[model samples]
Target: MKILVVDDEPLARERLARMVERLDGHELVAQAANAEAALQLIEERDPDVVLLDIRMPGTDGLVAAEQIAERPNPPAVIFCTAFDEHALDAFGTSAVGYLLKPVKTEQLTQVLDKARRTNKLQRAELTDSAPAAGNGQRTYLSAKTHRGVDLIPIDNIRCLIADQKYVTVYHTEGEHLLDETLKDLEQEFAQQLVRIHRNALVAIAHIQGLERNAMGQCRVRLEGIDTAPVVSRRHTQSIRSLIQQL
Candidate 1:
């Protein structure tokens, strides 16, 4: 497996490099002293895994990991940090593993093995399955586009519409077909999304208002979206109450 070591400290970078040399079947592709440099190296080296540090001089590991997750076939992230406080946040960015500072060689080997075994989708699933704590939800939703992997930020999302088996994500930028079911997305983002209809889930923050057509059919107006999704009769009252609070 190809690997990149990203740390602000030179000694820490050297130590990790030496450890990678000791391990078999792995190559140290490059090293970066900051998150910005690491991102650049990722574009150039295209490593399979990155041993990242959480507390960097700029950008920080959490934000950097989100950016990395947006890439097509992004490398697995294994955070090597002195602080364990960012563990949940690390996993939220679809990180495959987390190792405390003064990382042991054995631990590094185990994590590398695990990363090598897991693919991008599997890593996201692992993060979804992790116990919810301290904003453990993913910052962006990944979808396979004709161009490549398209990452839609959760905050920019207006609504998710289900058409038969596929779910389409409507965000601020535009729409993209998601390789996910509406039911699964509803359950995963229950707190941030509201089930306006059996086939639709709208972001709670994007709910502009509820409207009734001339025929008394209810529809929901969402911020930044031209089309208003229909609201089921069963959920109309509930949506009204929700809007009252907002």
Candidate 2:
């Protein structure tokens, strides 16, 4: 499979490319330092797979995957990240597969083979159907809480409210405060998440609908739950867009 290696670190990309070269069936077609360059290379090279990094200077891997998958012919993606926890949910993005950092040769070969097989199966299934927006698959959240790392399923989350420095992820079990800033997580889970407010990120599937009261204050109702959350004025348009799409 022809592959494009993408990462900000020169050594990381080089090492990954060399690994790909070591594999018999795989070929390194290009290398990119950021998402923009990756996109440009995708348009130009049309490689079969992308070895992408999660974090970058601008337009992180997740955001770039969203845009690339929206394109006419997007190459399969395999996130080469340092975080092992992200591996479980990275497939929800446009990623066909994922590999942890300092990626072992054996693991790389295994994921590459899986990517090829999965790609074939996916194409066969979509052969008779129109191109869909996305599979509508929900991803789990790995957040570091007081006790330790907690796994919060996206379906259980009602909304994510951004505080001064942290984003409060509200779920049926209880609310958990995560350390990462809201904007970072927003980009990572853009498909399943919606920016309901500058300080809030609401799961699109959880949103039942918008209710406008006599006072002209509009609130968002959570699906399968009774509590209604306030929708900030700034995010009204995006909320409406999400509702219409759904």
Candidate 3:
């Protein structure tokens, strides 16, 4: 597990880093002296766990934890502080673990276990709640970025292409990974994207024209995309009829 240690005291940070390194499977990615630096490290490294100190010079750990929670994929927060009064407040922010310092090795181990379990549950929830395009009310794909969630409008999507187990959603900005399958995407955006291939779906608006190559196979060209998606036999007739109507 990747870990980021955040504490204002240099000795405390170094001590915590050493203790974390001694563990079997944990990797100490980086250490930060302040909450602001901690937030920056979190954004850059995306550590699985953050051992945060509650009291700092500026931007206290609680405030930083709240900001971390807002991230698309936030790391588990384990607030390690000398004060016991902030326990309730820490849990309220959905902190996975809390350690009262004068640190204990056994306590650290237990918190690490709890943090892993909590992180798993959070990821499961994200996967379950991930919005799909087909829902009438959900006309956007909530793509999780390095920073936060980006709500991509369906109109900006050019196509969806399946690569192995994952589906890549191509939009005006770029492509984002989708959790849904090609079938689900087609069902959701039935009014917009037409299935050109078994693994591909193209936007109806971008469907400029069709071309038949020397091999007598039909292909579709989009407005800005140069690569043509081949129309499968089953969808070819319907696509042709739809183009004629337009």
- Name the candidate that leads on TM-score: 1
lDDT per residue as tens, model 1, 1-246: 999999999999999989998999999999999999999999999998899999998799988888887776678788899986876676455566788989999999988887776545434542443223467776678765322234567889999999998888998989999878898888889989999899999999989898888989899999997878899988989999999999
TM-scores, in order shown?
Answer: 0.52, 0.50, 0.51
Please give the TM-score that candidate 2 achieves against the real structure.
0.50
Cα lDDT tens digits for candidate 3, 1-246 = 899999999989899999999998899999999988888998899899899999889899999887777777778778889887877676555566678887888989887876665564443233434334444245567554432234567778888889898998887777788767999888867788888888999999888888998898899877766567778899898999988987
Clashes of 3: 1
Which regions in candidate 1 have their CA more than 4 angstroms from the true location? Answer: 120-246
Model 1, position 191, has a per-residue lDDT of 87
- Give the clashing pairs for model 3: 134-188
Backbone-clash count (model 1): 0
Candidate order by decreasing TM-score: 1, 3, 2
Q: Between candidates 2 and 3, name the one with more favorable lDDT.
A: 3
lDDT of 2 by residue, 1-246 (tens): 899999999999999989899899888999999999999998899888888898889888888877777776567777888976665456555455677899899988987886776564332221322223356332555454322134466779888887798778888877787766888878867777777777777778778789987788778888755556677888788788878888
Best candidate, lDDT: 1
